[model samples]
Each structure stands twice: as structure tokens, then as C-alpha cells.
Target: MYLKCGLLEDAEKFFGEIPLGNVVSWIAMITGYGKHGLGKEAVNSFNKMQSENIKPDAVYLAVLTACSHSGLLEESQEILLRLCCDSMVKPQVEHFSCMVDVLGRSGWVQEAKNIIECMPIRPNAGI
Candidate 1:
């Protein structure tokens, strides 16, 4: 697709043409933006998705990855907090891994270690 091909502008234009875009469509856009290092744009798309009442499930990881790659430490933490509070979506190990990466990348190694220590789930090899 255009997004996978790195055609972000074309992807956006095509996405906009959908009459009733679903959560999957939004995820594609967010993931594409994240992969392309457009963290702000990814967050904006996430907010827009929420405004439309499309509850986030596992998509938090994508946003977190975006924030991590872009060095948006605060934003990543905020998203993790929101994920923790959302009863409908349980936080996965992958989510925690992304948080650790974000924190560590931002030079918060101690905080990252604390998160690893305090997390209910066991840390995987990726962490």
C-alpha cells in the first residue's frame, strides 16, 4: 500500500477518501506515521480516533513506538498512564517494552528499571 511504500501523502489522501473509516484504517495511518517518525502526527491521529469514539485496544503500542522514536518522553508516559487506566484494554508486555524503550532512550534508565521491577507481568527477552 501507499503507507508501506513510504508514500505518506498518497496514503493520507486515500485514507481521507474512505466514507466510514474503521479502527483498522486509523491504526494503519497511526502506524504509518509512527514508522515514518511523525510522532506528532501519529498522536494527532490517535486523538482524532478517540474523539470519534473508536476505543483503542492494542494500538497504544504503535503510539508509544512513535513517541519513543521521536523522543517524546512525556507523551509516551501519558499514553502509558491512559493505557493503565483503561479497563477495556489490558496492558501487554509489548506495551511495557515500548515504555521501557522510551524511558531508556530518554536517559531515564532508573525509571525504566523501576517500571520493569514493578510491572505485574514478567519481562520478556525484548525488554
Candidate 2:
């Protein structure tokens, strides 16, 4: 509720009040921080989620977006790699798009192109 209205502090307080916050709730906070371009906060929330033993899925597109916007390219790449290698979650078109965008924004156009070329599946129009 507070996050939807851009009330981040209020949202945080509410979030902390949710005893044993579930994955959905944690994702909400992460998404909200990302939407606001609070990359560090979003990353911190992600770490907190992991500490709580909440497994993240491909829905971390929000986190990727936040990292890209905040210029956390390394973190974005690490997240993608972790998702691909350590978890059962598969990267979607949205994740690839976000990665390319981040790389391009950071002047790594060639790297972005490499990602497109190396994609396991056919690169979609979005990529």
C-alpha cells in the first residue's frame, strides 16, 4: 500500500511489522525499491530475503531493473549468473533485455551483443 504511493519509509515500517514476511511480501519491497531506483536498498532487501531462506525466482526482473538503473552492472551480472548456475530459475526475455540495457548503458555494447549472441535460445525481438 505505502510502496504503491511512493511512501518508502512507511512501506519499510509496515514490511518490518509483517512477522515472518513471505516471499511475496519481500518481493514487493524489492520491486518497490527497484522502481524508485534505490539499487542498494533493493539489493539489501534481496540479501535479506536470502537470509530468511526465501528462494527467489525469475521474478527478480525488478531487481535487475533496479540494478541497471543504479549502475550496479556487476551486481546485475552476478545475479543473472547466480540464477542461471545456482538456481533452477531460468532467464527469461525480460532478464536478457535488462542485462543488455545495463551493459549498453554502461558502455559495454560489445558485451551486450555477446549476450545476445550467446543466448541458449533464440533471441527474441525484445532482446
Pairs that clash in candidate 1: none
Which residues of candidate 1, in runs, are more than 4 Å off? none
Runs of candidate 2 exceeding 4 Å displacement: none
| Deviation from native of the Cα of residue 16 in model 1, angstroms | 0.9
lDDT tens per residue, model 1, 32-75 = 99889999999999888889888888678888888888888888
Local accuracy of candidate 2 as per-residue lDDT tens digits, 1-127: 7988999999999999998888789888988898888999998888778777787874478788889888889999988887778556777878888889999999999999999999776888878
Instruction: State the TM-score for model 2.
Output: 0.93
Clashes of each: 0, 0
- Per-candidate TM-scores read 0.96, 0.93
Model 1 — which ten-residue stretch has the worst lDDT?
Answer: 58-67
